[model samples]
Target: MTNHIIVTIGRQFGSGGHEIGNKLAERLDIPLYDRNLVNMAAEQMKISPDAAEEVDETGLSRFLAYYASAPVDYSSYYMTNIEMGQPLSEQLYQVQSEIIKRLAGRSSCVIVGRCADSLLADEPNLINVFITASKEDRVKRIVEKYGLTERKAAERIKKIDRERRYYYELHTGKDWGSIESHDMLLNVSAMGIDGAVDALEALYKAKK
Candidate 1:
């Protein structure tokens, strides 16, 4: 059967979620949307890629994104306090939501983060997965990947996870990383990244 299943993954900071998503996409021969969603949203917003990155996913309140997309010159170039009702982070989220919907409409693919699970919640072919790991394991992964001390890795994980949680909650009105919000929650600390991928592959096929 030709399956068109959309898999959306939410991961902890150092849980190897992106790696799992990338591997899953490769295994299934489907496109993976992770960091590339920022670029795609930038293009959609008619702004430079870096502009989108400025307000990409941190949920920061800034006007750089507004200035980048708005047709305003120096007259209001420094109007960083302009009230556009929605923050730059929210605007980026809206744009990426459109992209996610369009991508899901086109074919089966794997989307990492950006609250894609909630955005595509109505689709029958949608499978939402949240991957997590123990703090110890995650800290080790972060330290190894970034050459950071264990203390630094733990700190970084806390910061990014908090931002992601707030971002997800702000947009979706759902508790981030909760099992009830997703279709499947994978604890890959012991199973490993590839093992998690194997389980997800089976899930996609079984869901079909």
Candidate 2:
């Protein structure tokens, strides 16, 4: 059995997934990959970070459709043009997937979002987790974190969740947030961030 483990976390918008991931990584003494993933991919692809973020999870379908019909050699010439090649979203996914794999190979780490669960699904020591909270709790969290009103936070939550669902399903051909899609599903609202981290740590120890 492999000694290294990778923890992939998929989360609802206001579920404190980021915080949980940070704590888990800190406790485990491993790196945490989150938004920095975009920066890394941007650097690898030689594109601006802003450009990568714009298309991150929102452009997967268009990229897939374009690539499916485009010629295999299309990237050879198009890649030269910053905005003319494969969709930025697709490029970001490809670059980040490679980075995620490389990171897992080097050491155990906690990765939040960017479809890391699906990207590393085949790894023997991978633990795929989905973090969520009740709608009420999520809304309250979003309001406090983003300084948004209750109505605005609720809207933002729906929008982000929809984008995430589309991106994950598009890439993995699996239902996002479904019990079967993850090895473990956690409710941050009920478990709290520390509780969730402890639960994951226990699971990891048992797996080891």
Residue 144 in candidate 1 has what lDDT? 83
Give candidate 1 misplaced runs (Cα > 4 Å). 1-3, 59-84
Per-residue lDDT tens digits of candidate 1, residues 85-186?
665566777889898888888889999998999988878788899999999999999888767789877877887788889888888899899987888789
- Show where candidate 2 strays beyond 4 Å: 58-85
lDDT of prediction 1: 0.81
Report the number of clashing residue pairs per model. 0, 0
- At residue 8, give the lDDT of candidate 2: 92
lDDT at position 32, candidate 1: 98
Candidate 2 lDDT for residue 82? 57
Assess candidate 2 and give its lDDT. Answer: 0.81
Please give each candidate's TM-score. 0.85, 0.85
